[model samples]
Target chain A: MKAPVAVNGYGTIGKRVAEAIRQMPDLELKGIVKYTPDYSVLVAYRQGIPIYVPKGKEGVFEEVGVKPSGTVDELFGSVSLVVDASPGGKGAQNKRVYVERGLSALFEGGESPDVAEVSFSTLCNYRQALGKKYIRVVSCNTTALLRLICLLDRHIGVRKARAVIVRRASDPKEDKGIVNTVKLDPPSIPSHHAIDVKTVLPDLDIETVALIVPTTLMHVHVVHIQTKRSTSIDEVVETLSSTPRIVVLEGAKIGIDSTSKIVEFARDLGRKRYDIYENVVWRDMIKVNGDELTIVQAVHQEAIVIPENIDAIRAALRLAESAEETMRVTDKVLNVGLQR
Target chain B: MKAPVAVNGYGTIGKRVAEAIRQMPDLELKGIVKYTPDYSVLVAYRQGIPIYVPKGKEGVFEEVGVKPSGTVDELFGSVSLVVDASPGGKGAQNKRVYVERGLSALFEGGESPDVAEVSFSTLCNYRQALGKKYIRVVSCNTTALLRLICLLDRHIGVRKARAVIVRRASDPKEDKGIVNTVKLDPPSIPSHHAIDVKTVLPDLDIETVALIVPTTLMHVHVVHIQTKRSTSIDEVVETLSSTPRIVVLEGAKIGIDSTSKIVEFARDLGRKRYDIYENVVWRDMIKVNGDELTIVQAVHQEAIVIPENIDAIRAALRLAESAEETMRVTDKVLNVGLQR
Candidate 1:
């Protein structure tokens, strides 16, 4: 079998995937694609790995064709997997180009919903996309969400699930800290991200409400769930812990303020970056009564999609294992790093 | 019996109280206090009732030697009660002249916390201040939190609570459409307000994180709670709804923009401003497995405090009935126009 794969697109999750690939003995470094003039690109460049400057300005990255050479394009054909860490909406077709070149690929969420079966990160719903050409990482809101709902589905059947996402928008250097962008209206629940999840889980009965916060780092989600059978707090935490890519943090030292730290923390402890799980919320913040439970989760918007894109790539390639099995494998790989 | 009490500071909440007091039969037509050189003052002057202006800057009326009508002041008593709608620091006791008057008084939460024996408002622990000499009308963060906690306390026996409050800075006349002054650190929670509650309930336990947001209209509260009983969403909803001064809302609303709209929806319908008693959240947001529950409440900072100021006036007067009983009487008296 080929060694584990190298990842590209280092903005939010890209850097994270790059680090995770480093930890695995099986994965070989292929290359990284970053916008020009970024400090992170310099950091990667100093490390001596091949770094490709994707030709284009912002989204025009899409229309510009990236040709593969023995030094560049040829590598795309050999790499086991490619993760599209490029900003959402900008990397849609580039993901397909990888597929057309016969390279496995993953795309960040927020792109238009794709019909090709693809894998979602640690929640591992890859079976649905096993042997498909395209996959999308669930949105940060959805990534944080589906892992939770899937755990619920395992315990009590979920009749309906609802989430009110109080999302903080990134501080764009160009916008000068003034959020002038008008966003999702009525269907604003992660308005840009939830649509893709619906494409994957069509009948799951879900809705989202997204609000742009004035923060650049992470998205804090206030989640409420309804299950068929009555569930308890302990059961929920335990189920999540048992799942792959999900961390159930219970200590105060780990909170939304330090959510970005989870990834770095995982790295510090020598674990896979995608393995970090849930941040245990304050007890008083949750109002769980019977089958309906309410809680909050803060996700490093970038990290969630990195693993998401990785899983999406696995599905896009129609890897050897079933999608469910691939998801299981990804979860297993993520867990190995979580314990560290 | 008394002339309709004139309310000063008619911006966010001052407006709510002015309207509520207008509906009361016992309160006759005294004009509102205009904060000099503003549209609100213009509105007050046009109303045809005598308006009160402070000693500074040209108002619609001439500045006269103002003596405090003894509530807390030792000077001569003028109005039966002064709703110190003035901003937080300086109270109804304008100067030595007002202080010596011993005038009847009420203070919005901003000023001297010690001055209020019984502070009143739509939310917060009015029950604690009833019959006391000074009542503090709490800030909006306190109102939203206290109402929900009250629900949990009454129904499920709260053990410990913590809240993360996101607040809006003072409104500027220029317009709030383009503004973002968010302080992610030092997020003020209900804890500061809880200190006052603990003054009454010594054993009460809670920790709060307060954050300032860019918007000027609403205050968002993210709460974490530990309860005595494990319950379901229905029980929690029923508990929240049964409380006084709470309006519960479902997430999917069209055309509802700011917290003002949420409160206005209730006020227009003649309902409590804390119209949304419960918001639907997610399962994973629950941090730890405990007797604790997590929830969120949003409040219109101005609206919630107005009634509390009125309640404090009645409570400080040591009216025979408690604030709970008085609220009903006061609401009934003011809402009579609708019944008629």
Candidate 2:
């Protein structure tokens, strides 16, 4: 029997999670929850996925001419797992509802680790989340970082890591009043990212500073990692290329020169909303100087976490015996890494 | 009296060099040399800058309905310095003409070090090029690399360096039939960029790989430098921030996020062809992990060499006694780091 899962909050992350859950063979998307009768609510309805509204906001859905199938409270009893894709702080508020119903839950990166039994990254702590009542699937940025770090750590042992996140201001669908000027994160030294990554790999030394730029395309990351052993650029490339979900982009092989072109390639391939589920690393940009490895990669902020969400479902419920088995199934079913 | 300077070739590099020379108070735009009466030749004519053609191509200009002021031979006798902005190998051919005329000439990075008396970068070797007969202003990529390297070497010694060049396939005007796939420079290992940078900083150990991406906007570089001494990300940022021609972009302050938005910002600023002449370093992307310093910066391929061309003119003609004075004048006239 497929494990039933409900996606709460139909924003960028919520909508993607719902679609991914529906695609997985081991999971059933019970319904999607939305606070307002936005266009996504209509999309969820048209996709034949049931939609639920917050307890107090049910009346507003009819005013917007769309009928939600039920209230969010009704979703708790029907699903074994509740994936909270709500806005940053809202996950904490919604966690109470899930806990009271004794349902396993997954929260997005926006929430604190305290909100869940454990913070999760499929590559770093997939096994840890198994049989856990609550798991927080790390944010898109953390997921992208973890993929590289886990690969490097496994192959050559990462001694230290640093990253600069050129973040997108907002998702294409929503407007949060993106600023025009590039400003440093306030109290800038060791931005919250460093702390977040630690939750997965507690001993790893990583420092990150994030800047929100005015483009809705994707977040570009410039990463520098120092390896424990000597390695060459070619060796580093070979290692990363072999890793799953890490798409190595060569300008000649893929005919894509920039992140914008990568988006175009995805759209041309008829990907869902041009979503690139993999971490697009510039194949040419992977270099090793002495023991340091450097790479420039683009992370599609909205889509990267989608696959992780799917894996987190199986992980939270102990459905998959191993991460490799879960990742292989997810990639095969979702067509993840086939773009290249 | 202004020193007369002639720019040979009417491609991306040549046009910018001609315009920059025209704007400088210390130099006079003698004439621009074009092998073909392309649209850019017409542009030079419309801008009231005198246009010259290769001896045999003079008639081609009139056939294309654009009048040439004289042959390239006439430019040799009229100018004190000739900046060879021609195609890669063409500069070697033009070098013989400059020698025959006893005219001091500056070659673009396309030419080998053997073609010139010294390889010049305003930040690295302006003094070395002073009063020299022939000098090659390093390529846009080399110039950008030198800017970071020189600063790092000065603040904290650099033990070694590695770089991945995410290069643009073509300039905005030309269509070089850019391929979609990311390709390593054929015979891939260490691209010529590794050697090219050594021309400016011979003692610095560095290795690089270049891939041509299908974007005319700019080239993004992922650089990792192992500092001789340990450093912090804040110290690295402060050092780079103080360097001239290095624009540190913070996502919050400038609202400029991606390379495309940067192009848009340049266009909104009413820049020449929306060109970003400086090396735009993402402030948040600079990180020092252990002993390794990492940065991601964008180089406007066509425009980066423009300022170096101006400085080369000064260096070749002995117009400025110090690089600081020449750079100050060039920045004042061209508005180098004011994009933000």
Give me candidate 1's TM-score against the actual structure: 0.59
DockQ of each: 0.10, 0.09
C-alpha displacement of A11 in model 2, angstroms?
4.1
Question: Residue-wise lDDT of candidate 2 within B1-340, one digit each (tens)?
Answer: 9998898887888888888888899899999887766787787898999988777786778987788889878877899889888889889987888898899998999888889988988887789889999998888899899988988888888998877676666776775735433333532446888898998898888877665554667777767788998999788888887756888888446666557778888899899789788888877667677787777787888898888889988988888988898988998888998823
lDDT of 1 by residue, B86-205 (tens): 666666454233345454556666665676654344434555665554445766665556656666777778887756565555543435442332333332133366665553345767
Model 1: residue B220 alpha-carbon error in angstroms? 5.5
Using all chains and alpha carbons, the TM-scores for the candidates as numbered come to 0.59, 0.77
Off by over 4 Å in 1: A1-10, A33-40, A52-72, A95-100, A119-121, A171-194, A251-284, A312-338, B1-76, B84-166, B169-217, B220-340
Q: What are the Cα lDDT values of the candidates?
A: 0.54, 0.81
Model 1 iRMS = 8.6
Considering summed lDDT, which 10 consecutive residues are worst modelled in model 1 chain A? Answer: A180-189
What lDDT tens digits, residue by residue, belong to model 2 across residues A203-313? Answer: 998877565444577777767788999999777878788755898888546566456678888899899899888998877667676787777788898899988888888
lDDT of 1 by residue, A1-340 (tens): 5453545566656777776565444456677665544666556666665565543343433234332212335456567677666766766757657767776666666566662345364453656666554566766767777766776776667776555555556622234432422122332223444564565566776655555555554566656567787878777766666654555554344443333444455557664333344443434344556876666566655455544554555555554355455545554555532432
Error of 2 at B218 (Å): 6.6
